[model samples]
Target: MSAATTAAGAATADEELRWLADGRRIEAIEAISVSAMARRLPALVVRAFRLGWRIDRGAVGLLLTCQAVSAVLGAAGLFATTGTISALFGPGRVEDKLAHAAPSILVIAAAAGARSLLGITIRTVTIHLSPRISRAAEAEVLRATVAAELTAYDHAGYNDELEAADRGAEVCVDIVGEAQNLLASLASLLGAAGVLTVLHPALLPLLVIAALPQGIASVHAARVQFLANRATIGDRRIMANLRWYIHVKRNADQVRSDTMGEFLLAKYDQVGRRLDASSRRAAMQSARVSVIGAAASGLGGAVVWAAMLWLVSTGRMSLPRGGAAVFALTAVGTSLRGIVGYGADLFRTGMYLDDWSSFLDTAGGHRLERGTETPGAPRRIAVENLGYAYPASDRKVLDGVNLHVERGEILALVGENGSGKTTLAKLLAGLYLPDAGTVRWDGRDTRDLDPHALWRQVAVAPQDYARWPLTCRENITLGQPTAEGDAAVLRAADASGAADVVARLRRGLSTLLAVEWMGGEELSGGQWQRLAIARAFHREAGLLVLDEPTAALDPRAEHRIFQNLRAVARERAVVLVTHRLTNVAVADRIVVLEDGKVLQEGTFAELVAEEGGRFRELWDLQNERTGVPARRTRQDQRTVPDQRTRKDQRTLPVREDEGSGR
Candidate 1:
């Protein structure tokens, strides 16, 4: 097997074992005991009921009334049946017995019919309420996920918990049915038990004994299945991700170009096989337990029947009472089985709901809890002794970084990859909180400001901006349109050079940006980047962070963007991060960073004139690559000879030769 497959399999096995251990702990708590189930049953029922009540209170009330009425009718039907049996068995003329049993027969029919109607009503209410409950649960999960801090995504534990909560949301609807089933079963059990007690007290205990073995088997089987499902969670997630990669239109071209279809399918198959193996093992174990329990149940059933025979054979119980006992015993047994089955199902679903509830309460333990102070658009954003390290990482992405940008100033951050340029810009924009020091907006710390309110004043055109599958207008406005509306969108589009792109669209501003939908169209990489830039331009924000804002643009569009940037920055503090040193000329000040620390800070002319500096070295190298003469101060122009040829300029060394004053 390939290393990827081998590693996946190993990780899956380890997770499966861990989940199995958790299942064992649950099993210990829920072992076949009346006290255990009784303790758990009330809480699970109340939780389900609370959810149902929240969704549709009328339906919840109707469901409860129907179950209660159905149980009463069931008990009434059994009593009428007993009366009919007693009349028929009495020592009397056949015609007389038939006449005496007539009313009892009608009563039984009425009770059965009423119970059937109640059952239908119960079903209707459940159907009406289940979907609403499911949607509400899913909505709550989405809200919690959205409310969580951005840094929450950096931790694997948070993601795993999120997946579990999502799964819980899906199964949340099942708890409604399970809770109702359990209630109905309990009602039936009580009515039957009561009837059996009236018939003869001995029969109730005997019926329970006969049903106990099967009840235990059902609970054990459910636990096995739950454990199996828990074990396969990681494998299932892997399959889902792999399937998306293999099936999505975005990856379709690459899958075919790289001949990756078979490789992806093989990994999928590997994960599927592991899941199948666990399921099969669990099924086999459940079957073994079930077979043993069935045998024990059969023996217990025979003992109950023998006891009934003894009661009848002795003059202790009448034939009519014995016949009623038979009916009551069957009812009790059915109810007991229903209770065990539904209770097990309810418990399983409750565990899933617990995950959902826990996530909502803690948002995977990463809920945002910033201050209530909502600051207005910042006049000056400052970073003082800023330091940051990503969750679970020892290496700092930014450390001791101090910079400031005021309104109307364009500060350019230039750095190589992993040199913390983007991280520094994000800190300036209040996207992340520094661990060591403060990022302040107009004198107020960002940490002391409401995150949502703070973010409203910050606009970002990131390197990897989203290609939102929305209308062109919506994409530009980001669903938060200003009072100017389409006019604002158009102006921003024009500024970002996306006006021409929008004009070519079938619906102009109304055109959907995804091809998967009807009447929608896809944009080229450069076109998409323009829309991204337009979104940033459209936002009326105090701070603007543009990271590689023109990476995908053509030379003309790139030049246009930088040429107009200073004008755009007149009302906001613009922090631009780019590797293209040529673009830094647009900024009032340039800060060159290397290894998370400032290497140089100056104007484009000053940095380029400082010979042997990192910025000067980089500037010369870029000039060499493009066969352009390096920017020089008037003093340097006088000291160095002009290169004679384009070829010589292209081959110019980064370092000037000392003592060779050409």
Candidate 2:
């Protein structure tokens, strides 16, 4: 990369890193504590269950029922074990004892079988429900993104929030399994604790004491990993972006020709190494905590076993009850360990889900809030004292600008790069609202109109139009076909010079535009630009905006587009923004902009007649480069009316009168 390019990339990377680190959830993770996790755990579990219930209530209901039944069966099996032990000890003959124990053995087998069946049912329901929960979460994210104002994308923080929410959506499915395990573990612990209480109240407390250390260790390990993940979020994002640049097909040629593959790979490795270091530190810390906890837990278990022996020796618990205590203690201990492990996983997942939920709640803090007024096709669209500055900047892109366009007129915007030509065009189309003055359709301000309803009357062929990976027909119509259907699409294709390109496609208008797909085809740059223009032409709107519309077209195609421009403008107002001054000859009037202010405005002939004007200077520069004559003859210029007489005939300023088709 050039030095300037490298500097720009570094600046962007720094901004992104700052944004990622400033995330609300990242800040929360930095200060994470066991007490905070405990407080948040209930709300997170409730949210997960609510989400599952909303997506598929039947599956959620089935899952809960199965868990409850399985817990009951587990408790019954423990009770049956106690009965069998008691019967065997109460025997006269060995044969008599075995016979008496048979009924209890039968009950134990039945309970075990039922519990196994219930476990299978729980797993099946969880599998059925998890994906739907994920899909619902993802869909909500998409909806919130779409509802946000166009200006929302200008903020780095908003983009960072979107990335985090996407990760949260992806992990949403894992929460379902975590929740099921947590609930099952809790239920099992309760059942085992109850059985042990019936055997002896003293033994229930022993079970908790034995499991406490391991439970604490599990939770601490989970906290360590979660914090590590949060710390590396920015680095992971950087790595993902680098991988895309190195792996995408569009960059494949540049990678080889510029010898950038190794450099890119090295950058990727650098980011990956940072992430790996964080992971290693987390793993070692977790291991240390686990080892210490295990040693403490071993000591606790010895104490519990010794207490049980003393109870049995003192006849506080009989031999039959002692055997049952062994089974109950094992069950309760395992369940407690499971409860801790699953709870920790669920808490971590819940933190990520909070990102998703928070974004949906605020809609990236830029959700659209426009008026309810629906506008029809406007006869005249007006701007007065318009000004705007993009997010995160004080520099105004368009300041104190005034302009208008009416139906049946074509107004051209001409300027050097960064002169706000495209920004002005966007403002006129209601894609953005001005920071200072009003843009109005007829007499109503744009802010007073329903945004979607207003946009329905506008069509745009932007400088960087999307190359939709869809069928040619869908690309042209943008998935909104007219009643005329194919006839309308064909007419638009012919007008934009894309009919020839479509005819050469393997499946004509049905051909897919992405080459990566099976049986799909790709288009050259010029061909894609033609399709983009056709998309705007296909829409039956009251206003049409084309920015650098012919930038990629050949001379003949460019000529054809300008030749048809006046006819297209006969039905709707047209705003044309381009650097190709020759094409502006077809415009009814031209406006020159410099540094966010209008420098000149007139008919093409009038602008050309002004000797030292910006337009004439640009025209002369282009003429010299193309080896054409620098100026028209005096008599040729006289053929056009003088600007003095034209101004005398207008009652309003040139900006409004010219747009009024005077």
Candidate 3:
């Protein structure tokens, strides 16, 4: 097959892989090999240290110093205890032995007290540092997520990756703690080993032998758990979304209306059971490994005891020195096991941290196109043979399509659902860079101009406009907050029919818009649409793209919006994508799209005059449904009366019955 075909196939496979990740089944992530993990451990440690250090350098340094000094104190305490034991058991008078042992006992006490103080200091520093590190990491993740291109949200893989990364960020503070503990444990283990070597050089080798089995087992167990977690991340993300849909206030009504409580509850139970079963299996495997490790450790301890007895019997070692060696050997073994356990924990935490790092790379790779040149408002915007496909999809949504819009012209794009009209509009608005064409603003390629600068000249009202849960004023002035209460804000609100909507509010423009909030009110669908249009209008850009702007409006409100289109277009270009054919009748130009291609383009009258055309067929169909005559003269195009009065606007009033809210 050709290279394009191969790429398309790869994309299809990737999409299929994502499709399988719906929390219904376990799909294991490819496991990292032991060798690979070993190689990556050093890098992960360095990264973790840097992550912690960046948030609070002083605290990290202090924490490290405390751990190092505490380890040294630990070794000193072991040595002091050994000396005290030897002195007490030596052949001498009671008073002499007591005098000899007293100094060593004091040293032991001082070392122990110092270690305890250092431990307290470490805890204090860590407590202050964790939240700061967590916040910083969280901020980085949020920044990367928000700055990513809009197209990334369309793919399940991207969202799953982001969710995984978000989860990792949440636990990053804990990972830092784990790293610190791991280092501290390593120091303790080394201190014990040093004391063991001092007591008897032969005993140090026995400590290593005793720890080998448990170390292997701990690492193996960690790997098993890590694999389980990695495999379940996508499922966990799906579960989170489902839980949100069931419990969040916004989705409550839909859940009740559709009787989805039982269905969603069943889904929850099903996923939960699968996860529980997976957890049980992983836990069983780890337990088995631990048992085997315990057995090996007991056998190693027995061997060391046997060797010590043989040395004592042969008189090769003194009884007092041998007893100290045995004690040091036991301490070394315990500490070594703790170090291994901490190492396992660090490996697990490091893997999760890797998710955060991987997500940053993944999201950052698909950055918004950036350029150095700033662009001015365009007199003409043109698309040349545009072709585009969504991420991880084989089929192109727009293909070989060309179009143009200029100042003072209203271009109406009318097409059926899934006909690429919205996609074309996004390309025109510079929200997306075309895969196989150029969008030019005033004869200059938009790719060469800064995207932020280019977007300033364009304003868009998307079909599914966000209903921000803020004050009405804030929502309307979102794009032009600095122009709030200015003549322009009011003018845009008036032009979009939002001024009348705002007039009916209890608190007027300052009223919050979320029904779930105290003293807040919800707007009717049409009113919200009007507010979205107001937001777009507030931008006062040179190019305006309205996608189904009046879909929820009543006949009169819809008519009022189209009636003002000529005035709105007089100062800037307008691209209107709508299914309402009646609204298209007044456009200066009409473009017809079918199956990702431009089927026809002309004046509305010219298109209607043709006997056979997609535009005419759609117009005829709409006329039949509405029972309205087409080709109406200018005198016949009068605005309809306001069919929807005050009651139609779902505004809150200060009356007792209305709960004194808006």
Candidate 4:
């Protein structure tokens, strides 16, 4: 086949698979009779029962018991009904007929009353079990999804499956009830079948034949409903996301600022139109199927009545027997129709449950391995030829990078935006595994150590740190809950210059941090950054990685943090990743990275001493912007050009200090 044709065929195949997942397509009703559904009914019924049984075995058993009692009562009532009718038609005195029917009248009354009581009991049991099923299913889904590998969230397939599984959890409550009702219907059906056979064996086949068309219709309607559900799910998610964007407190400011209301509504309407159109089409198709089934059912009923009348006239069946047979046939037909309807519901629910099953299976494959080994506090961390690329991406974020940091030393990483500074720091922090090389902590590979154990020894504050909506004390203590009170918290705050921010709060540490909530207060960008820094400091881990830690801090606050750097490093290693070159002056070592590769590594003074190196050139450019001349000796000053000549030389803004790959 041509490529275009092949692609179309593949698309068609996927559509077919989705249809088959829920059984046959709606359009196949004419090609496949009700007999085809018989083969799959047993499996769907069993699965539905298994699900209900797992949620609440007691409820399942109670429901089945009620169904059994109802079925037995219904059968007795049918026979009593026949006995009463036969006595009414028998020859004798009026008194005699009344006496004979009176006993059956009481029997019928008892059976009817018991059936009603069982039905009520069934409803009560369902009420008790529905919420339990929903809660259990939701918990299971959340447990798997929350623990799934972080990389799984990056893929669209995982997101779609998650949405479907969430919907399935909600439907679980109804599925259990439907399955129970199906069981009850089957019981009623079997009871009616036995009655019809006892009255006259010839009538049993007619009951099955009468139910075929309605069964076909039920299957067809179910398939149409499933198709509509699957088709609109993605669009519904988009609409939901748009609604959240429009209505949530967090996005309200931006929505109003950018006047995004109209744009978002437009997108919502666009998806809404497609969803409405699909729903209308599905409804029309389902209605047509129902009409066809109803017409066929009417014809079958007519044929049955005609056959009964013919038999009575021919004397092949007695009047009372024929009457009872007609009643039994009607009951059997009703029960069979109910069975088919309930089966359709189970089939539809099974498709949604399939989504849940598939999500769990896929998540299992991607689950992060929990290592068994644990290591002591690292004396040194080494990155040996480390490389990393994000999932489904071709370009590497860190390429063949090598570095090391020792205890009680400060290592500063300086790089421009998108230069792999954060990615490298994350590798060193054991948050990600290298694609091609190893990160070793005191000669033990990070992959060999339990991730949870390794994470306990490290702390990180990224540029976009979380601002938890909690009390200030809770936020700070969140980093180290075991720390004893305000003293330790205030100490970390003082180190990061966050103490001043806390000192100004209305209630100090007791103040709620979320202004959006009632009786809560907000923090400015700089204050939040200080709090984040305080959190990291409170961790007191063996190693700390702070990415753009001073991004929101003022120059004075940044200077204070740098000045306190020596004291913070006295007990553990520190790695600072920032674009601000001035922050590196306090570091014992500095590494410059460009385009995923190490450009230079040394102390600040050593790098600045090189006349034409990349680090020295960057330093000179920054100094020129700040009106600080590069340091020079008396002999070098004598060689400098005169002021007027220098002014002319500056016209083109040429940097004579620009290095040529030295």
lDDT of 2 at 44: 75
Candidate 2 weakest ten by summed lDDT: 650-659
Which digits, one per residue and each the tens of the lDDT, describe model 1 over residues 236-338? Answer: 7888889999999889999999999999999889888998999999999899988988898889888988998899999788999899888888888889888
What clash count goes with each model? 0, 0, 0, 0
Ranking the candidates on lDDT from highest down gives 2, 1, 4, 3
lDDT of 2 by residue, 281-373 (tens): 999999999998888888888888788889999999999888888888888888887877888899878877877888898787888888999
lDDT of 1: 0.86
TM-score of each: 0.89, 0.89, 0.85, 0.81
Q: Which stretches of candidate 2 lie over 4 Å from their true place?
A: 1-19, 23-27, 30-36, 626-662
lDDT per residue, candidate 4, 1-662, as tens digits?
A: 89999999987877311111223433443343356656666776677667778977888888878888888888888888889888988899989999999999998999889988888998998888888878888888887785676666654456656777888888888877787788788887888888888877777787678778988898888878876887667778888888999998878999999999999899889888988999999999999999999899879878877887787889988898888877787788888888999988877787677677766666534556756688676889999999988876889888999999998999999877788988888888887878889999999888888877888889788999999999888787784575467888888899999999899999999999988766698888899999988888887588988888999999999998888878888888899998778889889999989889999999999999988987888888877766768778645655567677785653333355644433
lDDT of 3 by residue, 31-126 (tens): 444455456656766777788888878888888888889888888888887898799889999999999999989988999899889988988888
> Local distance difference test, per candidate?
0.86, 0.87, 0.80, 0.82
